[model samples]
Target: MMKLEGALYPWRFRVVLGLLGLMVAAICWRIIDLQVLDHAFLQGQGDARSVRHVPIPAHRGLITDRNGEPLAVSTPVTTLWANGKELQAGKDRWSALAAALGQEPKAFAARLEENAGREFMYLVRGLTPEQGQSVLDLKVPGVYSIEEFRRFYPAGEVTAHVVGFTDIDDHGREGVELAFDQWLSGVPGKREVLKDRRGRLIKDVQVTRNAKAGKALALSIDLRLQYLAHRELRNVVTEFGAKGASLVMLDVKTGEVLAMVNQPTYNPNNRRNLQPAMMRNRAMIDVFEPGSTVKPFSMSAALESGRWKPTDTVDVYPGTLQIGKYTIRDVSKNEGVLDLTGILIKSSNVGISKIAFDIGAEPIYNVMQQVGLGQDTGLGFPGERVGNLPNHRIWPKAETATLAYGYGLSVTAIQLAHAYAVLANNGRSIPMTMTRADGRVQDGVQVIPEATAKTIQGMLQQVVEAPTGVFRAKVPAYHVGGKSGTARKATVGTKGYTANAYRSLFAGFAPISNPRIAMVVVVDEPSTGAYFGGLISAPVFGKVMAGALRLMNIAPDNLTPADVQPAVAVTIPRGLAR
Candidate 1:
């Protein structure tokens, strides 16, 4: 019995020892992993949990008209997001989400089933507060919202071109939006939130960075003038059956862009049906051969160079002047030895061409170039064409003659108005500006002699006052002066030009005696009875100027003319002479 007891004891002891050995081995293995093998991995997990990240978008700035009227403003909106894993675990998820968010069930289901392995997904953008509350009320797990800004244009399509539009991300897309995007787009701020072990939010850990708001921009454009310009331009476009039209009103002394309007415009807010063509701002973007309107430049060039006086007569034959293969003629039958003033009054193409040949192409090109023709005005608008000006070498004899009368070359409405403003402002050429950055007026360079500018101003006055030009473009309160331009439109599919289709242009400034403002009006392809610039564009110019004058509070210069009355005495003796 003693021997049996000893053997059993030995067996029990070996079994107990084996169990202890196994326990020690397991503990050692775990210690090695915790101390060495898995140490780096565990460290990384901790660091990731402690560190937080958030997005920052620069808030865009405010855009206001000259009168401090808000044209564009940014309003806060909610963007919906979802945690895929959490959302998938929710009961009756798809139907609840669709009902809460006002989306189709099928679409919402498809979105959930999408295989983007991301933990988060965007459900929708630009949500109203009500929509956000509805989603939160659904109690669907993992769905959340973030705040963002959506731009709003108060004046709508009326100022579409001037105000421009921004993208979904609040980036400026076109017009003033693009021009001042950098200055206006503010920096964004961010914060980190701490979450408990079960992924429940604790509190905002810290504000990582503070976001900066964008700068506000104030334009030199007057909202009232802009409205007026739009009204007149729209009416003319309807009445004339024209394809499109543009108008620019400028401050002669300051070179401020008071008003610019383009027809065929679309609402910046509703961009679903926007056409690429309609999106363009034609005043600065497009250029055309400015027919008779250019004749003044030819005359100005001659007068500036002292080659001809305003009274100097050119024996312009009854009609056409044959140059190489081209024949240029007077638009009117009343042609003779015309003085420089008469040439412009009748819009004599032949007379101007003769003077251009006398002055020579090189000299004329130089003069035109100096006066801002065929040059970019640097208005900061995208896609501005410098227009077409043939080099001295390629200028055919006919080319020179044609260009002399505002053909064979092209100029923008902005460029034309700026050039005309030089005459209105006494020969000083100021840079065209949309912003009032440094001051309202910038120093101007003298392009034409003061005397020469005055002479041209006096001559252009006849274009409004003469019987032939009496279409009601005349301003009774101010001595206004400017010329009209009519150019044939080029065919779209071919290089050939058409006679009936014309781009009518009127470039002038008012209170001409002591001019304060300059403007340019261009109507493209008017199909109505009135196609001439003098007929279609001039009356609009007159109306716009009258309104602007009253707005500026510039008292009437021609009070005598306004107040004058005829003596009304009877002529007694003259009837019997026959």
Candidate 2:
């Protein structure tokens, strides 16, 4: 057997050894090919499969009040996503993953099928951190998440018109957000990341670019004053059952819009059923004929002319005066003559028409223009209106008479407040500002002579304290003065004014001796029938002014014993602001 084995296996052993040598030689050659000559290509393919450039999200800037309280802020959120192709392979676990995501298994499977061609697909956007973690705990194969931001308004609808809101992608959609979108938006950064076959981030390799955060913005709004003004306006609007309303308060010396509020507002957080009408910023956009509110400015124009003294008398034997085809009638049918101040106190349409005819159009138009009428406040707020102040080249007697009593032209609530501010501010035309009063604030222009402004201011005070004046406009323990206006709403795109549908407005400043704050209240189409400006709007002005003056610690100029009353305890409700 031993002799046969050697003889039979010698050639076979040589053949087997030859085959083994060939195999070893081929293995060495292959190793050399992969580790040297073709190394670059193999390494490049591996890197492509494992490395990716992932983006790092940059959040929006903070919008704060002058006191450093947040009006709007960016909140962190997570977006759940999946590599649909990888996820589709794990079909049995779709129910668990879908249940974690609060979706039906069949719908989830259908969704994965729809996106099977793509490597990535979104499951849900803007999920809470807890929710994202709960879904990830299921450990489904392609599940992942990315960080994002959402804008939240702390003051809610109270600051809705000013602060605005952003879209789901963090783009500014309205209000201040839209106005300063560029300043508020940030640049996202990118980093090289290593991921496994399941598309999970393994480790960060290197940063390509750094994220740049947005700049913080500080506004001129005093949150405290804004709260008071909103509360008062809301109460009055509800009490009068008005269709809508607006109130604007200004620091006359600084031209800062301390507070501005509008009714029928919507919460920016939940805009599911938002309507454009509810989002309207009435103070800045909506226009109404200012009615007798413009008389003071007209009087200022006449006084600047020096033709009519404050004590001059005017004829008003008949309540109605015929001017061309139009007849102007006074609400109070006074049979006797009244002085210049008496006209404003009684709000006689006849007296104002006579003066408008005498002073002509230029002076009145010049005065209106000087006090920020028919002009933008330079706040750059979205949808800010330059109300219609028709300075026609040819002024008809009818138009002039109507314009004299705030009929022919229209003005926004902000413009009316700005006009009264000029009277309170000694005829200085300060530009209204939404930003804080910094070096960026513009210098005021001299709109009217200081002497004439003082004279008109005195006359406005008389309109408040006079026996036949609007007593409701006078603030207790303070030398407050304002003029009430009851103007008829004009038919849209027509010359005819609507009867019974009126806009009750009051515009003036507190502490008539040394005016500090100028405010305006407009109640549109007040339905309770007690719709006169003196009866409805003036009371709101008085209440808000009384509170604002107290909050600002302004000393009372007039401490009359009869006008003084015990201060009611003030308790600010936390919810009203936000």
* Ten contiguous residues with the weakest lDDT in model 2: 1-10
Query: What overall lDDT, based on C-alpha atoms, would model 1 receive against the true structure?
Result: 0.83
What is candidate 2's TM-score against the reference? Answer: 0.88
Candidate 1, position 315, lDDT: 83
Q: lDDT per residue, candidate 1, 492-514, as tens digits? A: 78797986899988988888668
What Cα-based lDDT does every candidate model obtain? 0.83, 0.88
Off by over 4 Å in 2: 1-46, 103-112, 438-442, 561-578
* 216 Cα displacement, candidate 1 (Å): 1.2
Enumerate residue pairs that collide in model 1.
58-186, 188-211, 189-211
- Model 2 superposed RMSD (Cα): 9.3
Candidate 2 lDDT at 499 equals 76
